[model samples]
Target: MAPTIHCVRHAQGVHNLCTANHVIPDPLLTDLGHEQCAKLREVFPYHDKIDLVTASPLRRTIYTALESFEPVFQAHPEFKLIALPDLQETSDVPCDTGSEPQALQQEFAGKNVDLDMVHEGWNSKTGRYAPINSALRERARAARRWLKARPEKEIVMVTHGGFLHYFTEDWEDHSQYQGTGWSNTEFRSYTFSDEDHNADLEGHAVDGDNATLVETAESRQRRGKVGPTPDRAQQKTLYQLGTQSWNQQLSTEEQDSAKVPEGEEVNGVRV
Candidate 1:
């Protein structure tokens, strides 16, 4: 079987809470983001199945991986942490601009991040730091190719929301959200084509048609958040079925409403 790539959006960053005219360069995670990272240990169902843990070079993503997968690292010391600059957040944004490799190593020396694979000054933009959609697309493509070349069968990456949409090419899934981006600590799974010939010289294009998105525990948790919104028809149906099993007295109308309703809001609102 082909490897399963698990892309994880980093926990909330200070910049996410407050964006200034000057993008805060390589911001750290907010307290809420740290809380979310801690919850990932409980929410990530594939803890035992993961073969490796990789992350963007940015402080937020690196910290997310360190916090979220602490147990995995303890159990499987062989799975070293790799800091991939190619997988770093889009460079056009100020917050996404990473620190120098030496500085990062100095700042995060206690972490088990392997900086050898990262290119020198990989996240530094040459001209100006401004969010450019096209540039981000190209960077995502490069990151995809790099990930495809990895030997591990199951991999996890902690990265940024701005780059994830382009990386996964699943804009429709997140487009409805306020920022059209994923929530903090959101983890998604995708299965790529096993045949390397399917990718062009630039590797897989932004076309996600070839990839299959699988639902994870994190996604389910997002959907189950209690709010004023209408209940999901699937959840409602399952509840009715359970009632029938326990009380043996569900009404026909109740049973009929179990079917998933048309145009139901999904992939919206953060939990």
Candidate 2:
């Protein structure tokens, strides 16, 4: 099997939270914010396998990485840092970009006038709780390319808490509410492999055994990677169904709504 790819959300920031009143803004992790990441740095195989390093375009995530990955750079100065916009926090907290604060709850479709009960239907720009699924999948696809170029090796992504929360919790089934919020410092791995021969220069296979797999808890725990995974099958399944329903509704909405011209450009970027 190819090495495992680990996705870590940065430790809690001062601004790291969901708002009961409205969308959270500008809170960053405290001194202990990056402390968990710092401790994690001592455990993972950053020195052994990690071939690529990327982060969300957010400071919390970036700062968390600086502390955790000090050893990685000292060993490989040539490794470059890439910032992915898609991997950024979705609630639209504006920092210096001057955009107004986009409430995380308002992001959902049917936000009750009351602050607490956010509906899955009316939750995001995409109107899906699992937009993070799209983001994570894109990262995986990008991983295929990175692996092809680097040759069979692990790729580590240092990212945000919400993204990791959705990925491990609701991804396979699609759920609106994230099952669990992430701990300040958590290391989760999703492994990818290729079975088909249309292999890239790096070695990704296309067909058999080509599908990605998750490593076992025993294996991971044995390695002293991290912990706290209880059996979460039922909750995950229910959320998955809800996610599927919302996606179907969104598809219908898109079909009904008139779209811009195929050739149309918005700010030098096409829709």
Counting only residues 3 or more apart in sequence or on different chains, how many pairs clash (N, Cα, C under 3 Å) in candidate 1? 0
Candidate 2 clash total? Answer: 21
Candidate that would win on lDDT: 1
Those runs of model 1 whose alpha carbons end farther than 4 Å from true positions after fitting are 127-134, 194-271
TM-scores, each model vs. reference: 0.69, 0.53
| lDDT score, candidate 1 | 0.63
Instruction: List model 2 lDDT by residue over 1-271, tens digit each.
Output: 4556577767665543332211234345566665666677887655566666666545566556656776766677776555444455533333201111234323322411122222332223342323444543444344344533545366666765445533334243232223223345666676543433242212334332223335456545754647533334543454455444432223323523523123322222112
Instruction: Provide the lowest-lDDT 10-residue window in model 2.
Output: 92-101
Global lDDT of each candidate: 0.63, 0.46
Q: Give the TM-score of candidate 1.
A: 0.69
Report the lDDT tens digits of candidate 1 across residue range 59-109: 989999989998889888766789987676543456667888889889877
